[model samples]
Target: MNGCLTDWPGFCRQLQYTGERRLLVLSGEESWAQQQAQALLALSAATSTLWLGDAPAGQPHSPTGKYHTALGREYQHLVFNAFSGLHPDALGASAGALTAGGVLLLLCPPLKLWPGFADPDLRRYVALPEQAAGLTSRFITRFIRIQQADRHVLSWQQGTPFPTLSLPAGTLWQGQQDNRGCLNPQQRHALAVMLHSARTHTPVVLTADRGRGKSSLLGRLAARLLRAGKRIVLTAPNPGAAAQAQAHCPVPLPFIAPDTLLKAPPPADLVLVDEAAAIPVPMLLTLARRHCCVFASTEHGYEGTGLGFALKFQPALAALHPHWRKLHMNMPARWSSTDPLEPLLFRLLALNASPPAPPPAGELNIQWISRQQLLNNDTLLLQVFGLLILAHYQTRPGDLRQLLDAPGMSLAVVFRQRTPVAAALLQREGALEQTLADAIWRGQRRPRGHLLPQSLAFHGGQAQACQFSYERIMRIVVHPDSQKTGIGSQLVHWLKHNTQADFLGTSFGASPDLLAFWHHNRFKLVRTGLAADGVSGLPAAMMLWPLTTAAQTVLPVWQGSFAADLQDEGRNMPGDLPHPVPRVNEQQDRQRAHDLAFYHRDWHADRPALRRFVHRQPPCPSLDEQQQRLLQAALIPGADPVVLAREFGHAGQKSVISALRRIMQCYF
Candidate 1:
């Protein structure tokens, strides 16, 4: 594709070789892209416009009717000025709006020439050839590279006569003057307008298409503010975007990450936000919480969308902070003028102005199922765990084993469609001895498993063993898509229904969200205790819920032993129980039968690994001792000798009898 500006006169002559349908005028602000668009509209063409200002402050009533001008023509151009910045989608959507082989004209300067000009905002400009090629690639059918042209000067500015279109010898003087001067006349006008905004907290926006000197004005403003001891702070989406200000400023400016702005600011009086349009609204909320700030953005051209900027964000700013001041720089100080690729750049990168709202409750589909179900299917397990990995900071392979083997561990997954969208890991607790119960109440060991001696020492508790029942919750992760959607509450309710345990409990890294969720569910705050997790080193809460009349029977016994254990601290031991001797009852019969079946099935299944995994966790209560206690508790129900001597591992019948009576006292 090749052509000269003067190769044709008027619209008809230009259309001879280049169809008037799609014309590309590479003449910056002066480019005839708009003029050529008007000419195409005259011939009943359809057009999609991308303006580089913020999305039209609010919805600006677009020019109506199908015909271009008032001539009753059929051409209808839907202009989307992506004021925020360029968008790839908006560009594609815009191009698609044109008729078959409908013209797509791009207006902007080449990338190579931008640096030669002295504009500080040259960083915002995209390489014209690359952007044009990308657009052509995306909308192949409609966009054909009809022509490519280049020159030292962008467009003629009245009396400049070197070659009809080229700049005159003295034109460089004007360029030099605009480059180093303190905010050109147009920039000064914008800044003065900023002072009128009622919002002293106003964001002074210096917006324009690429090469319009937005950044240069920002740098000049920073230098002036800093010299005035106003404590100017300059920031951008990244350090590279702020490079111009950093290089041009007399003082060394430190760059900070956009995320941690609120807590770690370096005490500044004025904040200068460069390339403000590229950042989303949440970031603007960050700025609003600050003292004073200036937000500078590129309106149209190669930088980003002009229409989106004017339409989407400006009103948000107006409503959120009605006093914001807006300044638009209409003059170009970089290279000669605007880059031709601005329209295409805006179209592709700045299509959607904001994110769509979350799906409504009625529209949301939630699935509830157990971990065992997920584990049986390899695909289901992978999908569930994969979602967790994405949502959580830490989830490991060990967790899968824990889910399968841990006696108390269980899971409930929430699904959107067939996809598991959220999951929670639960731990169903087992009975605890008085000594063990005491240690837990005292915040002694983390999760009680690490403190084994405490279980063997306390001799004054028998009935405490019967009533102890609890369940502990472990990791609870929800999909990012469904977070804050009451899905977590749904999981909690599901757990309560499924487990039907006396008490539900858990300890985890303390987060406000987690804490609030639990608190909302009537999970009371009990005493705090240590529960070692990977991230949080601090102790977590120890809570309980009593389900049966047995709780009334056992609470006092456990409390007494717990108090005594705290007093004893490390100073106690009980005589070992005699060799196990079994007695029988219905409960014992059931437990013995269940255990025997489990052992035989495990042995026959040849699953030594699973057996080991289970045994290693919760240390399956000494089977022989367990059988002896079951037999004794069933036959000698009132006698402490049975529970104490067998379960507590006491050597003599006297001590066992004494422990049993003490525990029984609480129930009586």
Candidate 2:
């Protein structure tokens, strides 16, 4: 007690230095902090105290003893019991209630609690002190380390009575208004349904195209929750989306960090997540366990994981809660419904746009070639490279290795005279046993042939036998010069007809053309993900085609397994994890923007305007005469001077700016 009391005057002085403001006591019982809080309250009548304990005035059944009445209320001093595990949102809300220059007190572990009680399935990942520090750092201006006790004078039984809090204003959100912003009726409707629904556990999903108002809807719902006196926490791929939602809500306290809300979650009434597809499925599950939450996502866009969303997220949603509602918004919010830009955007994305071509009725002609022979040809490599570059924002040289070495599948190409007209890259992917399947789900990166054994060792949580096989499309490229001649569709038909595997699967960056094309080819919607591939930082869509009746029979079983895991356990269960998609750049830094434009939708023919832009620009060292010829061949209509200069030759910075200015002239 001597050491604890030694800093009494210093504590009072520190509180005085912080001035007459709010104080948050986070479940720690320290003699010094108690004395300091007492001294401060005695000295200044303006200060008030908030006590969060296991048994409150109301809510007797609350597991954490977290009372809802204290939510959204400002307090001069809010303290937690030494053993309380506050809800994350409540912790954030409590922090928000603090005035500027306010002091927050924290104390943890009465020694008697060391090696804290463990559970059968999962132990708490965080501790009380660590949780308190996380909240203090986010909302408080400064922290003064007070004391750490050696042993415990106070003790209580496990689950005796320690309650958490709900912080509605702790999270910071920022975004434009709906009237001044962009959103459609379906998007708005989905959000409203989530907002007005009963507070009981019910999952909700909002899926749409890029610029379709999904994120905006989340912001609107968060605002409604704030006004309803609920403690709401908003999270996204980054702080930008989180802040974007906070801007719409006027809650007094909203939390921003993961630890702030996750460690000691306050009593949260609702949570709104924007760009849900962009977050990894594991993190999404962790948040969803909170009970009442709304997730907004984009389908078949850059930010969404495309097939990952369909194959993974959709089932996860189905298993997330007993009653989950869904809505889709298709119309574009940024451009006109019939804008010509839509077609161009779709082409640039390489999404599901083309239907599969039919097989020859009678016999093989000069235009047709055997799949085995096609694999031997080297000329089709250009199409492969170009398509890969086009579909991804950052396809590295390593991907080329995977394409060349993928398991199974001989290749095929169709030619018009001497030049290569179209091409398709295919592989065998499924029919794996539980061991191998679990490994893939768990995330054991492997080459095509080596996938089985390595996955077996990784997934069983120990060594086990594995047997699985399936055919997958490694890459499918149609020469840009002859894109619309129906070559792309022919490739789809050939793969389905030729593959020996029961199920046919393809994983690639999602784009509008690719999504619609697969849908038309009888490939059902499975998953959606996010990425910054096609200048449309929307999520990608993943779909599957079953080539055999046997495969179809097991498809539902596979789906059931995934759904069960998500509901009962949350996130990836067997060895698979949900990959995160990239988001759109709102800050729009100029350099990153330029790089994004090149990596986005189109690498070769993504240019919107021709003449002024090409001729008046600086050039990259990578572009040579042969590349220039290829570009010229790919450009529609004709390449302009500005288009060439900006896209090809090396001009000075001034010329690049000039070319840019010229391109902007078309929009006007």
Candidate 3:
């Protein structure tokens, strides 16, 4: 354990021979771990090494908080100091950067006591009132168990030397460059598909697991287009994600943010979107319209595993562009396919969590499962967590921790022949004391774990709202393969009869289709954010189902108040001063509306008249649900045709406008 630890160099040589990576776990005190890491660093002979903790003053280090910066950058050795904090995201992202012939040095407490130690990272996610006092983390227990059993993982004890290496044989295919510089036929095929899309203005979605060269292929395609004297723009979730693409491209390509591209799309023959999954799907749909582009994303691992891009964007992509192409790069450019670390990382992070084979067509089983049960059952835990991951864009390992350890957490999973198909994460809140309710209503106090009641009292102007108990549906997700099968609605229907809280409710980023789903499930809207949220760019809507008569009577009054005030308008309308809209003359307004709706086609010209036109009864037959959705979206303050098109199953903005015109024509 002393000296230069000469075995380190030989260990790395073994990795190079096999074309694989290793996970080096240094378990013991921080002092002992740091010494071992320093000695290994001196002898590892790696050109590129990264430190993920408090390093010797001058080493290349990555703070756990900024794990994102390490992504898209390769290193031969990564020294992760778990004593600082065992951040699942940072660990996963950092591990990814460990290319073939690399080792991830995870320094932590001795295996036996590691789980009991208070992880600093947990403090960020383990919310207040959710004490971690007696809770045992199943995630850490499973992680350690796997590490000990794996031949690839070398667990070095405090006083002992590094474990003997048994490097598995893995293949390393040298990519021979063609005229286009493709490494293999698979990559060449992908590049050709992208080229065709660029030429014909067809949309393309390219997916891959981590370490696959999707980003590199994108760069090669960009270079090829540049050779053809084509205008190309590259964009990603952030700059770091675009590094690999930029580094591979000899020609300098301009990088754009997704938001900027959405607001003002640059004129380009092609737009290359790297890390497409990290960006919201709504934005992706808008970008899909702007240019013939290749949207490349990691199919799993780190921030992209939610399958949000695939589940939400691809289906819509197919509908919008029937000729849209799909390509998945299976060959790993950075490591061999049989790399032990890769598969281990996948299971450790639950990156590969997916529904098992679909159960035979039959009745589904819905059952309540406790967090304690989740802690002990690995199969159930992964299925439940994975379903949540598939349904959301921001699902992370911290969420898994919260689900397992947080107070008031409950789970309802739907199974078909023992295979999990859907899951709902529920939390209980509200029923505050009179004094605390008054304080929350007066903005004097903010209690933890009561989002519904706090919103109702603090913003909804309902003083007694906090006194009513609530069961909140934190998250609900149905398997992607089995969706539109009424499984999600079934889960909601089950909750209606099961909950005893005064109010059963949920909060979410509002979309037309999402709102309609809630409405269909008997939830009434109680609060609406006036403006779109800055980060998500989606309006916030809260809906509640009243379980008691008192809640039933109070919720409607709160909705009326919300309707009148237009709450988020407070930024512009300061001092809570009411600015009433003037009434339009009925006869003249009707005539003006007629011109706007049927002939003029300018709803903006006579605003009051257009409002009356939209709100008043139509001369023609009743509007269907589809027509109603179109009208609602059209009336919203800043409805974009691109967004409306995606929401309403239209192919493009022009199609959305045509639909709106038809809906308005009904008024005439």
Best by lDDT: 3
| Candidate 2 lDDT tens digits, 1-668 | 23333443344344334332223332233444344445544444444555553323341222223433333233444554333442332333343333322344433333333223121101122112232232211101101111122111122222243222212122222222366233456556666677666365576777766545565456667666677677777766556546545554555436455445566666777766666665656556667787477777655433424344554556766786757777788865433343232333232222333323323222322233433232354334434344444444333322332343222434555545444445555554444567434544334433344232332223211122123345556556665555675667777777677667665666554646676677667764333331333223344444567667865764554344324323322233211333223222222222222332332211212232222234344554456565555344433443354555655553743454343433333322
Stretches > 4 Å off in candidate 1: 1-138, 146-173, 178-183, 194-201, 301-313, 337-668
Q: Which stretches of candidate 2 lie over 4 Å from their true place?
A: 1-184, 198-200, 250-264, 353-668
lDDT of 3 by residue, 593-650 (tens): 5544554333322333445556676444677887887777776655577888888898
> What would the per-residue lDDT of candidate 1 be over residues 1-668, giving only the tens digit for each residue?
11433332333222222221233333333233344334433453334333322222342333221111211011123332221222333343343333212334433333233223232121122212232222211111111111223232223222232123221222221344444354357866664554433135466666765445566566666665666566667777666567655656676566665666656877777777776655554465567566477777654322233233454456766777776777777665442332223343332232212212234343334444554564455456556655544433333222333343333345667655455667766555546556545443322422423121222112222223323466666666676667787787777777666665665665544445555667677554332332223223334443334455665444444344333332223221111111112212233223222332332211111112122223233433334554444333523313344444656677766555443333222221
Q: Which candidate number would show the highest TM-score if scored against the true structure?
A: 3
Return the candidate ranking by lDDT, descending. Answer: 3, 2, 1
The Cα RMSD in angstroms, rounded to one decimal, for candidate 2 relative to the true structure is: 29.5
Q: Residue 55 error for model 1, in Å?
A: 37
**Model 3, which residues run further than 4 Å from truth?**
2-4, 129-135, 167-179, 262-266, 361-365, 431-449, 463-468, 478-490, 533-538, 548-553, 566-668
TM-score, model 3 to reference: 0.78
TM-score of each: 0.32, 0.33, 0.78
Worst ten-residue run, lDDT, model 3?
Answer: 568-577
**Model 2: number of backbone collisions:** 122
Better of 1 and 2 by TM-score: 2
